[model samples]
Target: MVLDLITIGWRYTMDFRRPTTTAPAQTPEEAYRQLRSLADESALRNLGALYSMAVDDHDIDTVVAMFAEDGSFTRAGHTVQGHTALRDFYIGMMDRYVTTLHIPNSHVITVDDDTATGILTGQAELSLNGTLMMAAYRYDDRYARQDGRWVFAARTLKFMYVVPIEQMPTSFGDSKRIRWPETPYAEADLPEALPTWDSYKC
Candidate 1:
């Protein structure tokens, strides 16, 4: 009897330390707002997936259509704004690759009414001048609702590594991991470049 009482007392202490509270029921307006937010987030995620599919298929028109009229895309310090510039940029990029496959992963998005932002990490396999290259990359994106649809407002691409598939074994050890054909070796732009990574080192 004494042991049972001790066990019960310990259980009560734990329950008091970690009290549980029931959440208030949502009103109809609150529920509707939540559903809308979920739909927007789903659309925003589809934007990234569709982009990868279009790029791999060389469907430049479809890729460009995913962006807002005034949207901008930036890569390697170059920024192209508006649909015309965006189209030209994508065309030029696609022309360099014989074929490509992009796999997008780990997309995190935040919705704030009609506007949102996201970060996407992905990898790609490209046939550049007959040399197969593997690349790990990330995209920082801003999105807006245009004509009741979510479209990219701006996107910036950054690379963690882009090396010839054959050189993958040794490339990670090299300080300069970006080994695009015909271009000078360049440093990777990722984990090490992240501010949080640096903060932890200190």
Candidate 2:
């Protein structure tokens, strides 16, 4: 589905810094290269927002289709790989969310020919068990061009904090911090080849 550009335009436009110089490219080849790079970067950034929208809408099919055939998604120690695994992951875990809003803060992507790496920061507000929670998170991603389109090769998410809306204190002065803890992926529930964030370069 085509996401509303206005929904994400503020972040995308501000984050993608076009070359300010009006100096003409030294050669036609250089001009073409610059244009190609810009296109790739735009596509990559759009993919990031699209992915979040898929999650928010509980559109797992679109999410899976956005990935390469062998792509993987990892977050909070749960890793799902390929279409089959992703379907299982979403059906059993992702679909449980009653409501969600994923607002992307920024996505900084570095493109290199057909391959790219990016870091994305965003806030996720979700309802669970009738309670609202907001999570500040980051995604470390790797992308590759497949069949003339950018697809996720791998995406790993790290959560900085998950704050309960009702219980959030007015201040945190000397208060103990709360954050997601590391847990090993359930071997019996997921594929054995689930990759880690460290395996990808960004």
Candidate 3:
């Protein structure tokens, strides 16, 4: 009986005291800043994905938009600059190639007050025209923060070699494939624990 009375008294004291709310509420400015930060992060992730898609589709329009006006692509003793130059380069590449697959990795974005810089690594495979050469390359990309947005500032591509030329099968008059090459441009495997679009279950 005494223990029950003591418990009732404690409960009454807790109810009367009213829990002290110590946490400070965010100010209006702080809330806005946090929302903007989230928006910027989303933009960066989407930008990276867009870059991958543009190169894969050989979409010159999208590719040009991804870079700044003076952005440069450097590879094989050549540096292509500006949107017009970029268009010329892409068109020329398409004429000499059937397809290209570009994959970007090791992404790092540094935000500074009003500006940011993004550094990343990328790899590509290009199927050339006329010859059965497979061009394999890796890239180091630099992006700039402009007008509250990020854009590619420069890109440098390094290639080990244009391989698979020796494995080309002889041309035949018919549609049937007679000779199979020992080596082909096999797609690179995704890293372990890679998250696919289907994995989201969205």
* The candidate that achieves the highest TM-score relative to the unseen native structure: 1
The root-mean-square deviation over C-alpha atoms between each candidate and the true structure, in angstroms, is 13.0, 10.7, 19.1
State which candidate, 2 or 3, has the greater lDDT: 2
* Cα lDDT of model 3 by residue, 18-84, tens digit: 2222233389886776666556656776787787788678787998888889998886448999999
Q: How much does candidate 2 score in TM-score?
A: 0.73
Collision pairs in model 3: none
**Model 3 local distance difference test score:** 0.56
Off by over 4 Å in 3: 1-41, 130-138, 160-162, 165-202
lDDT of 1 by residue, 1-202 (tens): 1111123211101122111323343798877776787799789889999999999999989999999999999787778999999999899989989999999988777778889877788999999998999999988788999889999998888889999999998888776888899999988876665544556556
lDDT of 1 at 107: 78
Worst 10 residues of 3 by lDDT: 8-17
TM-score of each model, paired residue for residue: 0.85, 0.73, 0.54
lDDT of each: 0.81, 0.69, 0.56
